[model samples]
Target: MDAEIEVRDVARRYQKGGVQALEGVSLRLAPGTFTAVIGPSGCGKSTLLKLIAGLEAPDAGEVRLAGQPPEAFRAGGGLGIAFQDAALLPWRSVEANVAFPLQVLGRSRRAHAARIRELIALVGLEGREGALPGQLSGGMRQRVAIARALVSDPQVLLLDEPFAALDQILRRTMTIELQRIWAERRITTLLVTHGIEEAVFLADQVVIMQGGPGRIAAIVPVPFARPRGPELFADPAFHALCESLMAQLAPIADSR
Candidate 1:
């Protein structure tokens, strides 16, 4: 099967060789799959995501979305991103904030208005449509960010710690909600996160990264079925994947 997302032998350097953010890194995501990338900070997790998003140019190697350049794919409105920061415009109401992407893309506001409403409802923020970003809690803002990302129905979704601002309990709740939302769309997704359980629970494949000038240390396919729920936590394989991922990240903590 052809990969929906591919990163081949990618190397990126910053500050004229001050730091080799990534070197010889490779990755692939099958069409309609969810993949999570985890590693110590500065391991180039975000860099790789940026390269795939066409936000940065790799010093070497290439990133392809469906065998075409990221820019070309994105030009067709095939790319979407939700960052850890909600990055909502404080003055805009939730509805307008969710509709911001459409406005930026010069899409017809009337044509996509129903989709904007559907996304707002999809993210469970229907009643808060008129609320301002400052009026909502951190999690709600992230929800708005998510709705903004998906309102355009991009074929590939890129997420970077979209739930990082929430507390543990809320983060878990949002994680489950995100899974349900993702199930509805089934877009190819790559998420960069620090939460092992989050990564294991949400990913079709959990990629563990280690070493400087980051490279894929291991990739473990999730063993559970889709539309996963809390019952999945009871599965032995779920706990095992969590434990295994923690083990891989353990060394990074110890060496620090």
Candidate 2:
């Protein structure tokens, strides 16, 4: 598969003293590849995602999604995003929130009704359509967010700490669920997360970023085969790879 997302020699800066958020950062993602980016808090992991999502522009270099600008791609419904915040409207029911994006794209309610239902079901919220965000548990809210992100049937998915707020057990289950969802769709995905274990468990490749002025430190290909589950946690190879990535991030974390 060819690269679906590409960031070439990109740079960004803001504030006095020319504080750079990222410098000469470059990356590429293949079709259907799940990539997790891990780095210190100031490493601009989220900024990289925003740049790809067309929420921000890079100061230098080019960012392309399958040969088009990020905005153009997203405008065509080729991108989806889920963030840590969930950001659901408190008054909107789960179904309405999931259908918001499709509606914004000029899709009629009739045209998108089936897609919205499918997405809600896909995220395991089949029975919660009438419930408001306040009525749902944190995990359920996150599922609704995920469903909203996927409702557009985007070609790419960008997740920034989407499961950070869940309890450990719920997080693990959600991770398993996300893996299954990804398996079924095979959409190219880029995830920015702080969890080393989660990065290793869900990613085909893990990207390590240097903190001071974010740049690629290393790109580690995960050794495990796909259809991964909680069972992989006990495998020696899984622990070994997780430890290796942890060691690589140690200095970066300490410096922050």
Per-residue alpha-carbon lDDT of model 2 for 38-137, expressed as tens digits?
9988899999999999999999998999899999999988899999999999989999999888878887767888888888888888888999999999
Q: Which one is best on lDDT? A: 2
Q: Candidate 2: deviation at residue 58, Å?
A: 0.4
lDDT of 1 by residue, 1-256 (tens): 2239999999988987688888998888999999999988878899899999999999999999999899888777788899999899999999898888788788987898889889999999988889999999998889899899888789899999999889999999899999999999899999999998899889999888875667788898888888799788678888887998888789975664
C-alpha lDDT of candidate 2 relative to the true structure: 0.90
For each candidate in the order shown, give its overall lDDT on alpha carbons: 0.88, 0.90
For candidate 1, the C-alpha RMSD (Å) to the true structure equals 1.8
| Model 2 stretches astray by more than 4 angstroms | 1-3
